[model samples]
Target: MEGSKKGYQFTAGQERFRNLIPRYYANSHVAIGVFDISNKASFTSLEFWIQELKRYAPSDCKIILIGNKADLKEKRQVLPKDKLPWTSESKHPKIIEISAKTLKKPNSILDSIASEGLAVKKARTLKQEEEERENERIQMYGEHSETPPMRRRKFLMCGSDRGQRK
Candidate 1:
């Protein structure tokens, strides 16, 4: 596959091997879909790969679409003005163009993935913290308690249910 000008030609043998690819996606927090900008077939296959990612990856998985071989401008088949079919999707995955051979803005791809991964991690942490707090509150006061512990105590001390009790 390396140094192949055709860019990712899938043989019949490779078709069977693709089944194993989805297993890796199960635990993925981020998936990068790279296509050769100079190959129109490669660009067209991006949709298929994106569909596979969506089908196998976790629902929260972030996707980054990259168009490689930016240095081969003369041979480019996927132009910047071309509209990606997936762009209208709700997720709106981040897209970038780069040249792996020249290392052109490659860091931008890594940065986008890292940023998305961090955001997902932070959201998970906050959700876990919220769940923990809810559990603690449930333990301190019965789950059916209409008011929080401190508020209930204050209400009792005042001997009034804000005149709700007749």
Candidate 2:
């Protein structure tokens, strides 16, 4: 797909079996969760897709939530600003409204998705690098000691087999 300024090649494939996400979701960097705005059931079912994507896809995968059929705004069953049930505070999907049937520039959506995907990938990379550096520093200098070790305490054991006497 054509990104904001460049083109990115993707090995895109669709699986009609919704339950088999684990079998096909490996190594994916970007996942687009599409739902029909006119169909409330479809919109509600996006949670399943999101959950499956998060569980099965790579840890750094970016998800884009699309509310399709923007031209059918009059018949929309799902609102754009409605709070989704499955969104996570730490990893919220980028929700966008689009009408493939009426859009003059389809590349705009592609560009947005691509740009967001790249941003997510870059952020994850930097985070992983930072974590590695922190780990290396810990290995080199050891973890910062905050408190002294507690001394071992002696404990008396009373056992019936030993016939304990006071």
Candidate 3:
């Protein structure tokens, strides 16, 4: 069989994954970077996917990191909640542990992402509004850790909802 002939020689761009990201995930809000916890060979592939997204996607794209195939505890090359820090440390991708065999904590990882998606959408709206005001350049990251020299965006609709909810 022609399929069996190629099955003998496996590669990264196999038919299963080829065009899968664009065809299926084009309109998807969340991009999940998943790797086998049992395979050391997959340690770097996840990093490659993240870089691909950053290079091709927007500045505030939503991504959740998944360390999959964790049911085989003894075979786990990387343990649960392993921090894969390949980029800016001040901002980090959340590392999630999930086992398809056990179905453990998969929803927690996805639920957190849903919440973040809402924030990302809200941020996009805020960015659009800020864009209208030709003078405002909204800083994207690390706005929480530092106190501003003065509270200027106090009337900003994006942040005003935040303070009202608190």
Candidate 4:
């Protein structure tokens, strides 16, 4: 059997990868910018990545800056805990350092990601349930139903929970 001809378009960019950002930006909820601690050039490109994410990703998108190769401190060019000066906004991106080779404990970087993911999941679930309940109430009584009391929503963060008006 003769195979049918198929074609695909793939985009390639330099290390900064500015071209790929627009393709995935609209649907992405999280943007992870990974850089090597042993390479100064990779670390320097992080600001450009952040700028692209801010320009294309949704306003509520969460950004994470990671400094990899933590185990290779002997060859390190960038400090693991260097503070980023540009992310001083209200919703600052999370900064984390990790080494794939030297993770020993259960409380590793993956654990942190899981916990944060759980919080975001819980918040979305709660919002969905609230919307369903509201819809049910609207269906039962006509459009003139009394407005329900507004409840304070609890937003979960890395290690704390904060309240926000809903």
Which candidate's TM-score is highest?
A: 1
The digit string of per-residue lDDT tens for model 4 on 35-76 reads: 888998887777776887789876655676677777898999
Candidate 1, residue 142: the lDDT equals 84
Q: Estimate candidate 4's alpha-carbon lDDT, on a 0 to 1 scale.
A: 0.64
TM-score of 2: 0.62
Q: How close is candidate 4 to the true structure, as a TM-score?
A: 0.57
**Backbone clash count, each prediction separately:** 0, 0, 0, 0
For residues 37-126, could you state the per-residue lDDT of candidate 3 as single tens digits? 888667556776677666555667677767788787898888654556587765567777788888988677756777666677678879
Error of 1 at 147 (Å): 3.2
Off by over 4 Å in 2: 1-20, 127-166
Model 4 collision count:
0
* TM-score of candidate 3 relative to the true fold: 0.60
Model 4 stretches with alpha carbons more than 4 Å out = 1-29, 55-60, 101-107, 136-144, 147-166
The candidate scoring highest on lDDT is: 1
**Which lDDT values do the candidates have, in the order given?**
0.74, 0.72, 0.62, 0.64
The residue-by-residue lDDT of candidate 2 on 1-166, one tens digit each, is 4343443333233455655667667756678877889999987877777777778888777787788898997898999777677776767777888888987447777778777777776788798999998787677656873322232122233333456566
Model 3 lowest lDDT segment of ten: 1-10
Candidate 4, residue 88: lDDT: 73
Candidate 3, backbone clash total? 0
